[model samples]
Target chain A: MTSAPVYLVDDDEAVRSAFSLLLGTYGISIETFGDPAAFLARAPKLKPGVLVLDLRMPAITGLQLHERLAAIGCDWPTIICTGHGDVHACRRAFKAGVVDFLTKPIDEQVLVEALQQACAALDMRAERAEAAHLVAQLTEREREVLDMVGRGWSTREIAESLHLSPRTVDTHRANIAQKLGTTSVAEFARLALIGKAP
Target chain B: MIAAPSFEPASPRMPRRLAFLRSSAALAGGWLLLVAAFGLYAAETHRRALEQEVSESGRALQRAISQRVAQHDAHLTSLSALGLAQAQPSADFDLVARSILRFYPRIVAIDLVRLGPGGGVVSSARAAGGTTADPAAVSAAVKNLAAGRAVYGADARPGHYRLMKRMNDTMAVSLDIDGRGLVEEDELPGWARLDLSSAEGPLLEIGARQAVPPFAARTVEFAAPIASETQPLRLSLHRTVTLSQLVPPLPLALFAALSLAALVLVRSLLAHRREAALARAAAEAASRREALRQHETKLAHALRVNSMGEMASGIAHELTQPLTALLSQSQAGRRIAATGGLAGSPVDEVLAANVLQAKRAADILVRLRAYVGKSAGEAGMHDLRTSVSDIAALSRIDLGRRGIALDLDLPEAPVAARVDPVEIEQVIHNLIRNAADAVEETGRGDGRVVVTLTRAAEGAVITVGDNGAGIPPDILPRLFEPFFSGKPEGMGLGLSLCESIVERFDGGISAENGPSGGALFTVRLPAAGAIDEAKEAVQ
Candidate 1:
């Protein structure tokens, strides 16, 4: 499982140095770039990540970079940092892909909180990807009978579609749940995203 | 800026044109009268002299002819008797001719033509000199004589005295006559003097024949047949008269006329020269005035700039504070942004509000451009109170910084007057600054200046009140004089030139000790054009 890479970009050296230092306290290893171009050059590594960006810079604003990142399928979580105005550019960064925006003269606590959310999002995506991999493994007959039971099919409908007896179909569903390591057929059906994800 | 010259005359400044026009009219009238009168007087004298000349010449000629004939008759009568008595005609003929020659001083010739047995005898002529005359003049006289009338004519040659005369219808006889060139210039009453008179321009003039006429005081000529009806003989006399002799007043008239003409011309020339000198002087004075005005303007401008320079540090502080706040707010926002989108966050509101604050910070910069723009004379009607308030606003912080107290007693209504707002503001500000400096010098907490405005009979009155030590007694009278400053830092012309401009507007300004123990400057403008005074109907 892979956690997303978070991009942090800023213009001012002191602000960038100190801001990244505060973000480091949240235990999130941010891929820092001093400018948008440095950030954009690495954007192709779209293994889902959070982007922490500065709204204002000499070349290629944070909003524009958000657009560039979004174009490259790099949308994960984006955060905008600004030293002066919480301007249209900052709002625009959020709309482009940024999850949140912050102004400079920052409180160290806020930076830690924002970075923690972004890292947690990355952890959730990794867990979800491992779970999806585990769900990909199943026997074909067990999967068909499990599909019929997961659809809330009655024992008579399963006998008509599969040309099997209703009692036999029910036994196969029970085996399916056991193989899937859920004690109840209901839990199996819920784990299988059965009955329209109810 | 072209305007009609104001009809209101300045008290001490006289108009040049009225003076010049008066002088020119007087000069031109005098010149025309003098020339005309002079020419008329000259012509009148010439006419009278010519008339007198003609009359006297006729009488003198008649007298001389009668006298010469009488003398000739006596001699000829005796000689005729002697010749008739003698046997040989040639024997005593020399005596007869000699007798005739005895009066040669007057006589020119003796001649005889006798009639004998053949219808006429041989005619013979004798003379002291040649006896030829102009055939035409002589023939005309002879023709008149043939009709039995005595005839005579004036001399035909110039610078010489001669005459032609004829008598007709008489028997042949011996006669005596004067020839054309027989009268010598030395024999005449005045021959040499005549030439001198000619040199002084012509006295007698004849338009026809273009001949130089002989001078004549008196002339006489006579013609008659000599004891006969067929033969002719004539006698003549002439005396010349000078111009001085004819009219004694000639010199006086000419002298008076020429002197008058000379006087007119000289006076006009002198007047023109004097006017030119005056014009040059006026131009020089105007040029000097313009130069002084420009210099004062420059001084006022520099003072304003220096006053603004004192505000430079404050302006920077005013600008920098907002920018710093904006930058700090932005940095804090960036730090806060590290967190995820707030759930019903108060931070979003702070971010939006900070953006509005940043724009306010930039507005201070826009207002600074006004002070940096060009300052020029733009005089118009302005509210004095408003201008004063503006100036006070400029100095408010400085006064506070210096711990100076300012007192304002402005009128409730608009106190309007014509002025250059910028320039007037500069003047008031400079005055206030000076007052502040004065108060600062004394280092007293009680220092105060009162600015007061009131409408009086003269017009609007403005006073800048100060409680510092008053001007020295010696400097009071010349306080507004140029280059005379009471302060050590003063270059002086400020008050002096200000007074000039005020006076130009027909206003008066003065300084005196206030009743409150301070120096007060009071400026009074004429109520004529001031709206401040126009509001008097209310009160």
Candidate 2:
């Protein structure tokens, strides 16, 4: 898999640059913005990546930016950094779906680990999207066969439940495999769950 | 800010002395007048008693003399009757005449004379050492026989008189009287003089007259005619009332002592009242001073708490940025070194950046320590314009973060005052922060704060105002009261501390809603010269 992109936003220039350089050494490429405004203007065009944002900033806070991104249908995982972190803000950030909350003079390893976790979450989202797109291509009967198969039903049971011949259920399963590119039952179940996710 | 009440110590001595002197003079004058009145009354009473005594004594003496002279007339009439019964001179008549003379010693002599030429050979009688009547007495007797009435002849001798009576126009009887023997020596007082006189002249005098000092004695006299048919006599008594008699020493001494005691009592009462008044005044002054001292102590404590709070928040924000940078750079350097990338990588640059950040954080700590070093600083003459501008510059950092614009309008000329620079800074900082908070509360996009400094008549005038929702009328009056807060996280000592610090240097601070709908705070400081003058005035 390609390395996921990372973006860091902080109001202080030195803190921004320091975080960028530190993350770069850990093989994490980062784009830095001086303020939340600059990061927000570029948020729309950004590919799915991990967002590392300062909790406190002029014009917008990290949590507010996270909400704004979610409003625009950009569901990137976020890691929040702050000069002074409080429990309420941390709790609020988590409630807003932020991956982590960290305070300044932050432990570099902890930040890197949080960023890795965010990157993994982003990769999982991308895979889920691809799986949902592949599931959309399946014919209606094939989708029903795949659903029954994901539910651990045999081909005869599927045929009996649908009032079709077992031979017809087998053909529908073969078509689902060709469209979804996964013949394994676990892959089938994963794609089935992805297609059903809200 | 509330001005400290001034108290002048009560000066009780001068007025108290004056009051004491006034009362003392009144008491003395009153006492003297009272004593003089008593003396006059006593002296008048003594004079009246003396006059009464003299009158009574003089009347008694007149009665005694009158009775003695009437007895002589009886004796002569009896002797003439004896002569008429015998028709010639007889021993019995002589014996009777002698008895009469002996019984009444005032009659020194007795004689019986014929009215014709034979009257020269008339019978005469005398007491033990008495002498015969003189030729004048015989002539007077003969004259008395012709008139048929008895009369006393005057000036027979000193204190002596003669009385004669007619016996049927043939003969007359005569008696020589001793006037001095009529009155007893004990009948008159030692201070009195008595005199008896006939129609002719003074017949007798008794009781030696005493010499009285002029203007020092009161004289009382009693005079009356003696009640005697045969003799025309007047009796007079003279008495001199001396000073010692008129004003008795015992009562006068008692009165003087009472007056003196009253004067002392009144003077002591006045002194006691003065002392009580002085003590009360002193106590009041002491209480006032103590109250003022307690107020000052409370104000100082509040100032300390407020400054410390501001310092804590300022240190937190100021140190965080550099610390964040330093930690990041050091961790980055450590990571590069562990991977054996230090020699040729950006490790040197990272280490240098870490040092710089550490120094930046240290510099911030030093500034905060200096700020918190002195809780109470010495005041000095400082230009208000510079202080206002400096505070404005400092507040802009925090205000800008909240998107509040802070502006300064400082005069070119210096506005100077005697003030602790740190405390003044705290005042300006509190005002600016409050203004920013007010502006932010409104959440206006164009929130602005303006701090203006200008020279004023008193000294310097600093006005900090914000274009935001003005303060509520109910809260405005209590804005500077300690422990009154409008914000959730406020300790409520900011504005109160500002007032205390400003007023400490003889300056004033006030808050009001601006005309254009914002909260405005004005601080006025007395000029350095004015403060010095005030100090001199106090001294």
DockQ each? 0.02, 0.20
Interface RMSD of each: 19.8, 14.2
Q: Which stretches of candidate 2 lie over 4 Å from their true place?
A: A1-198, B1-42, B73-87, B116-118, B134-148, B211-218, B244-280, B298-539
lDDT of 2: 0.76
Q: What tens-digit string does per-residue lDDT give for candidate 1 at A89-182?
A: 4434544556678654444556657766876776665555553443456566666766766678876898899998878877886676656666
Candidate 2 C-alpha lDDT tens digits along A145-195: 888999999999999999999998888988888888878999899889887
Q: TM-score of chain A for candidate 1?
A: 0.65
Error of 2 at B453 (Å): 30
Which runs in model 1 stand beyond 4 Å of their true positions?
A1-198, B1-231, B235-237, B246-254, B257-265, B268-288, B291-299, B302-314, B317-322, B325-539
In candidate 1, what are the lDDT values of residues B69-103, reduced to their tens digit? 44554555554455454423454666566555664
> Residue B285 of model 2: what lDDT?
78
Query: Candidate 2's residue-wise lDDT over B45-157, tens digit each?
Result: 88888888888887887788778667766776777678777657788888888887777777778877666644553678877556676544566546634545677776556
